[model samples]
Target: MLKKAGIAIGLLSVLTGYLIHHPIPAKVPDPWLFQILTDVLAFSELMGTISERVGINRWWAYPGRLPVPRWMNVPEGMKIEKTVFHGIESVVVTPKGFAERKIPGPAIVVYHGGGWVFGNIDSYLPLLVTAAEHTGFLVMSPEYRLAPEHIFPIPFEDCLDTTLEFMSRAKEFNVDPKRIAIAGDSAGGNLAMAVTVELVKRKIAGTLVQVPAMQALIYPKLQMTNYLLPSYAQNREFIFSKDLIPKFWLSYIGLSSQYSLAQIICENAHIDFSNKQMAEKFALVHEDRVPTRYKQRPYNATPQSIPSDVKKLLDGKTKAYLNKMMLDERIAPLFASNKTLLHLPYTHVLVCEYDPLRDDGIILFERLQSLGKESSLQHLPNSLHAAASIGPFDKNLYHAKQNKILFEKVRDYLNNMH
Candidate 1:
């Protein structure tokens, strides 16, 4: 018994040591920082074991539990207010100079990202404060409800309401109703894009309300139907793709319990195409869409011609869950009509080379520009997804140098916006 106890204690100590030595992501550069951060933020994979054992609607929010160094904290001197926009409570950050301005200033509504299952307005304090301060714009971030509870169209519609309401009352916040832009990272980008789609639809009704002046999408997950994008193969270590994608997808569509089965079905479904139309559609994101350099052997680079075991699990119920998201342009703005996108504002899309969603951003940028819409695309070849959230405005060295450059570029893009 004594020897057994010692062995157990020894193993525990090793695990504790590993956890302690697991370098917390800093603003400075660390070779293992991205890999380590990916592990910490991969709540889906972290919870996968217990997920099958327990019957719960949700697990804890990852990334949020991680330390956000003091430097990443929202800046001081920005006056933050609590207000209701379109009946939904919102957190608004403004500059002290708002009182002196007679003309409405540029404004932005930043949607926080957490795979659409996690995060809130408060979770994005740094981005809000930084954007408002650097770009000299009033920042309003909506506390849109999350999925698996509030569900799909609810979150997207909430953002749409916030945009319409915020645009209508720009004078109240001393913001130029016409200069307003929407910005979001990850799932929030999905919302921002959907809002832009809504704005286009509304514009058709009349020429009364002006649409957003610009949209800044930071590595958004645009297409759910195509998971075999080049980035998905190159960045297989991406926490969201390998660790969390289908889990969040199923949850958003109210299929949290069937995640394991749904994940299999979805994964296989992407590679399972019998129709000629489907094959051509999927080919749009093939090697041609990828930059030459990102096309490499590290990923399962072969065309997804062979189906996985997921096909065996597909059933009527399974198809229903997949269709729940696959069918809605609101869930996947990649399906938005070209007519709706033609009227979208000048777009600034940021794609990180090491992110699975890299192709998504590139495709969206190409789509908008091809339609004659004004747009810009920035490729961060050295950075990873959510790099903007790293080292918040030079708090530490984690990805400090990279983030500073990206954030400054974003500010410059916004400053130049009409």
Candidate 2:
């Protein structure tokens, strides 16, 4: 009887542990474990569903929470204020509070990236606060409408409109209108670039009076045309999988699963002739740009035809956002005309060796240099895509060191941006 009772207790413990660690997969594989691990690393104050499993008292909890507390929470050198700008929410952090900083420091309107699906201003608060402290610039990170609910053009318009409104009220926020810059990571990076293009168009049409002093794009996904880049092929199974890419794309466009997965995999639905021509021009490279090592692997050049049903779908809502001119100069910064490139401000671009977006950054850097724009490029040899955000949580000292390098580089750039 004693032996049987011990056996039962052991089985129960194992079952409970499995249940705690494994829940239903949420889009990404093993989401529950990922969330728990990320929360453990970032010191995120797990609210909502996340709080139940990993509470504040876990062994992984450290010097503070995963995200370091703000200065106001600390003994304080700066005052932080949370306010909503025209119904869009923002957290303003400055050395002297919003009232004092209302007209002096350079302003950076920041946008956080989550593939247009999941991420909030609070998730990136640590990075933002650190940026403000390091740059002595007033940073405003807006909470914009995400996808599958709001869809494309809506998010773009919201970001653009909010920026214009912010610029209009710059004096009230204590910002230097001329020194304002826009920056974001991943999807937010796409939005930032898109906003810059929109600003250029508006400026040309006499609708807008000002534009950003500079634009900082961190591992930006500039085009949807190339699904077969070496990074996409090699690192597909890395943290961000190939299967997950289409899933997010569909979510971004608010499309249901009615679109077949096979069609997307073949690039049938997304690429029309114009998109194909654009992809062939920019993504296809000469022997010089293609590393000798990458050529050993096979590449398929036979383009797949767009499916008829997909063509019909494209004619609808997605058409207006699809710019054949994106094939031209404005969209891909690397392929933009000399006139467009010359006007861009002093730029700082960071590219990671292992990141899928490395080529995009490299191409853009080369283009900027050719145009003789004052541009700075920092290539982090040991880093990977998403490394900056994951660096703090990594147990490996190497990642921690990389994070320090990234933060310092950004700090130096912002400080020197006069």
Candidate 3:
């Protein structure tokens, strides 16, 4: 059995080397190991789709969970425990000797990303450990509800609940509640955005507690209002492949099998624009706002661009439901007014140049800047979006160097905060 296992592993390694180096895939950059890995993971969506149909989609939970957290090596003396935060299950990780410290430490509430369909504390253990050790932060990660099962807004609420639980329990952990941060990658980043918007709108803990000290949105999916973004045209296969975006959304919104509704929503035409002026303003990506080269080519689309048949999906009760939710500050935080943005805490936005979500992050940062908000933007021009999650293990020369710089920058951003 040991001999057979060794041969299987050897063959897989050799295949990976050949796929990454010899011919080299396009759009996915060299150090192609990361690209190959992404491709493999992306393919799992097919299995996920089948599993969803069979009512076993949450398989990623039981098996994927059991192995990852058990194997991860955390910082020496880091106290890892499972706890309840406002009815939500969470993994609380603390730096060594945190409980005995005389002074309160900064804290971060992190969310895990799996296209909003699957991801749990176990999957994010490594990243949380890295964050805690590097930034000297007390990290709390909520085990939020996932969808196609829980549907939209439920996941956002879980995050909000956990955040408040942290705030309410801050003193017990020796954490300065006022110095807390919120962060996540991909779908988790989206939740972080919604949570920030909600906290600002609702006003919790009198003043500063509602506003986190900082937020890191790593490769977040911001707006589905437009599909003509430049990255969509350029990156057809690498990270966030063109075909999967719609499927992921279908799963998130619990409409995977509804072909017509899915088609319209996927094309960015699902929302009913009652406020035409604001909707028009938010519908398209602001060309002049982003980096110069992104404007090298022009993209033009209008409400009329999609056929009338698709728009029919917006006619009944579904339209009324989405009409309110689509513009909800939490659901489409980008639709948030400048006045709302001005009050937000310091934010660090990460954009992967080759990602479909790239334009969304860049434009968001630009908007925040125009509103005079304290914001920072980091653009990974040569790398694909969503690479942060898997980059830590890539041994390829280019992947190793760039990935290290990315995480170090993240740590520095959190650490240098005054």
lDDT of each: 0.70, 0.58, 0.69
Prediction 1 TM-score vs. true: 0.84
Candidate 2 local lDDT, residue 330: 31
Model 3 lDDT, residue 318, Cα: 69
Model 2 agreement with the true structure over 127-207: per-residue lDDT tens digits: 566556555677788878776566766667778878888888888877768778887777777778777766765676677
Which candidate wins on lDDT? 1
| Worst lDDT 10-window in candidate 2 | 56-65
Candidate 3 residue runs with Cα over 4 Å from true position: 1-32, 49-71, 204-209, 239-243, 257-260, 271-278, 281-289, 295-320, 394-418
- Each candidate structure's count of clashing pairs: 7, 6, 0
Better of 1 and 3 by lDDT: 1
> For candidate 1, lDDT tens digit of each residue in 1-418?
9999999999987875554343322332444655555555654444544554677544453544233443355556678888998889999998768646876678888998887877777667877777776666788998888877777778888998887898888898888776778889999998888888777777876757778878888889876677666677677654543536767777777777666554453344534365454455556555576656666537774444334564565676666557555646788777777777887877888877777789899988877777888888877766777777765545555455544554465556656765
TM-score of each: 0.84, 0.70, 0.81
- Candidate 2 TM-score over all chains jointly: 0.70
How far is each candidate from the true structure, as Cα RMSD in Å? Answer: 4.0, 8.3, 5.3
How many angstroms is residue 376 displaced in model 1 relative to the true structure, after the best TM-score fit?
1.3
